[model samples]
Target: MAAQFATEAGDEPMNNALWRYALQVYSRPGVESLLLRLQDEFDADILQILAVLWANETALRISDEALNAPDYLAWRESMIQPLRDRRRACQRGEHGDLYELLKKAELEAERYGLGLLWTVLKDSPAASENCGLQGLMLLCNSEKECRELLQLAQP
Candidate 1:
């Protein structure tokens, strides 16, 4: 299933360790729909959430400023958002091929953003404990919703 989203060979290998970790967490039951809601309704940045998860796993602290860095937002607005808009537009019609293409491009854009985030924290040391839940709470609409989403992300 993950192979469906992998970048082609000689394409810079976008599916790095952080991306793999995201796939693993995202594949957990109920996570997909919850994440979709977080994205569509709450304006949550999925890449930021994934980066925070990676930071928690690596014991790196990601400040709110870093998570909301201008570069990241600019990338999302220019790359991912346009693709997402096209994909959503295509979803309203019989444009399956176009939708699929847009979806792939959006995923690549997201991977690129995640890679940038990983680069920012590459030299940091691991923490003794994971702070994923706290990170999720910051992105989620409420504590209850965050807790529910965390439960879904966990096996």
Candidate 2:
């Protein structure tokens, strides 16, 4: 984990840490795939939380091949019961409560051969040019991040 993530935490901001952690988790293999699957199959609460983190996710994906091959929807069905059971359910206004969010996301990403999550984040049009450095930082904690991210995602 240390080798995969950035050690020096300069004035980058909270999102930088989030991205650093995300990339480490993605490079671990199986983690991205599982998380992707969890995104679709998990629950709305989980999906909403993911949507929030994804809003500011800056972990740059190191692998290009892994980019076009994210088949998470398929893996969700096979995830262990304990993992699924852990899936969080959020109410509509209950968007910004994702402190332990990484646990589930990490578990899923580790389950798949996914790599370079931040790069995947690049796919988002909102992140264009901006790199979402601030957005990621501000929303590093709960639905506040999700709400902000969602606003950023919106046209």
Candidate 3:
């Protein structure tokens, strides 16, 4: 699948860009647990958080109007959320294999959703020359929490 989006022989495919971004960011120390906590406790959208991080890192901005766009919302509700629910539902069950499969599906759905989001924001202007961080800060309930998360995202 990665080959489908590759521009050069050794390049990472743009098709899996979001997945790759997610993997790199999530692998940062303390990030995975922090994201999970935010999701489980605050009902936060992990994909949205990731989108914000990606935008900030890439010197792009996702406008509120784009984030609330009807088509994106529809896709999230129809495609991403259901897979996430199914994956989470299997967490407490004895079906380890099924759980893993659902987890993979959910991640795929998230990557697809992110791709759709990127398409929407592709031509949008950058928030600033310095790469604004406010988009990601807004994802958290408090400044302190947002600060912590942002720190983790730092290279």
**Candidate 3 lDDT, 79-146, residue by residue in tens:** 88898888777864699899988888877777777777766655568666533356755665755666
Which pairs clash in the backbone of model 3? Answer: none
How much is 139 displaced in model 1, in angstroms?
2.1
Per-residue accuracy of model 2 over 20-83 as CA lDDT, tens digit each: 4545544554545544544455332232233234443433322223222344333444453334
lDDT of 3 at 80: 83
Where model 3 places Cα greater than 4 Å from the true spot, the runs are 1-16, 91-93, 129-132
Candidate 1 per-residue C-alpha lDDT over 1-155 given as tens digits, one digit per residue, 9 for 90 to 100: 32332322433336565677688888888878877888888888887877776676556666677677777778888998998888887864688788888889998898887776655555455456667778777776566767777567654
Any runs in candidate 1 off by more than 4 Å, and if so which? 1-13
Candidate 3 lDDT trough over 10 residues, lowest sum: 2-11
User: Which residue pairs in candidate 1 have backbone atoms (N, alpha carbon, C) closer than 3 angstroms, thus clashing?
Assistant: 59-127
**True-structure RMSD for candidate 1:** 5.1
Clashes of each: 1, 22, 0
Candidates arranged by lDDT, highest first: 1, 3, 2
